[model samples]
Target: MIRHTVGRLVSTVVIALTLALFALPMLWLAAAPFDASPAITASLPQFTLDNFAAILDNPYALGSIRNSLIQGGGAAVLVVVLAALAAYALSRVRVPGRDLLLYLLLLLSSVVTGTAAMVPIFELATRLNLIDTHLGVILVVSGGLLPAAIFILKDFMDETPTSYEESARVFGASPLQILRDIVIPLVRPGLATIAVWALASVWGGFLFQFILLRDPDKAPGSVILYTLYTEGGSPKLDLISTFSLLYSLPVVLMYLFVSQRYGFRFHGGIKR
Candidate 1:
């Protein structure tokens, strides 16, 4: 009895400490942005909106959010739509070595990261006259993400009842119409998952945007966030913290909205 009690007490203390360690930084992140003289270390905030005002005064800060939205939204739409079409086709079709092809594509994409293939990617973009274009970045990021998204959505498609599609077909529905009406509604959760994943991926992406976009005004929040640091290499905590808060707000709100609306339902088989 004594040993069990002591062990439980020790575990509780350890858990508490662990939670505090994680919570402190989050607490700091929430508070520091509002602090008038925010520092690198966490402390009680002397509440002020001056940090936000200061950030607003910068020419590039607020506009970066719009840029991030454009890039993130563009990539997410492409990934979700293309992935849904590809996944459904792959699931319905029984081509020779279909599984192997899917696996091979996924494996290759995983192995060859954006950083590793940037040189060729840059060359291709340059040759195609796509440099400094938002479309170029969207296309590049979407290409890298499609394999994984397709892989994920394919499972969801496979799990859906074929009876629904068959019924739709018997009712004189076309392939596209059946897909639009039956399969899509059923696989909405999967689509939402991929959309959120793709948005976050593109929103946080630094290298692709940095390399592809030459105009500073067109830079996404990820690239713009980099400039928050000073020439001395120390972060300008006031500006950095405030901008970080604004930068992260959209993604967080999106996640919360999706979660509440979709409730993560992949199939009717899975209960909420």
Candidate 2:
């Protein structure tokens, strides 16, 4: 018993140590934007908001902030809507090729790198006359996330009661109306989950926008971060750090707010 207890204690300590290693870097990065003085920037010291202010003051940096919101918001909206519809069909209907289609979606969701098909995607976009535009990036980001978003919502939809749809049908509800009223509400938590996920996913996208978007004015936040990173000669480390922190605020706050409510409970693979 003593040996077992010691082993458990050691395992707990190891996990805590591992978590601390990751947490410390994130914590330091969160604090980095608030340190602006030469001493603070160099030596690592107390917090200040000057870094944030500097980020705002830089016109190009400010544009990046706007770009982040637009891209993230657009991607989130697009993914959630399309995913919800696809998920509903996959979960509730017996459509032909559904399983094969789902397998393809799963494959897409697991894509490791965007660069593998970069040339093809760029060529297609050029043919569609959407090169170097926000729409181009938004579509790429949306399509990339669509599969996972669909899967998540599909799982949730499976967990939802089918009686709701049956009742709606009995009342002569049209399919579109049933989807808008019954389906959307029944799986709102899953939708919320997808919303949070889409925000985080698209916000981190770098390579798609980096290669596809040549217009500096239209580049997303991740691309801006890359540009800032590459311009090591005129280093804006403080602003970059500040922008990173600022960009992270929405998702963190959203999770915190939601966590206080229902909290996340995974009812995996449950079908009504």
Runs of candidate 1 exceeding 4 Å displacement: 266-272
Sliding window of 10 residues with minimal summed lDDT for model 1:
263-272
Clashing residue pairs in candidate 1 (N, C-alpha, C atoms within 3 angstroms): none
Query: Candidate 2's residue-wise lDDT over 1-272, tens digit each?
Result: 99999999999999999999888768766777777542233356466878777667756666876787888888889998899888888998998998788888788668744677778888988999888888888898787788778877888877877787799899999878888987787676677778778887877778887877788888767777765544346656676777877777777987777656536545422345
- Which residue ranges in model 2 land beyond 4 Å of their true spot? 37-48, 108-113, 229-236, 268-272
Question: Residue 204 in candidate 2 has what lDDT?
Answer: 79
lDDT of each: 0.91, 0.77
Tens digits of per-residue lDDT for model 1, 51-134:
888899989998889999999999999999999899999999899999999999999999999999999999999999889989
Backbone clash pairs for candidate 2 read: none
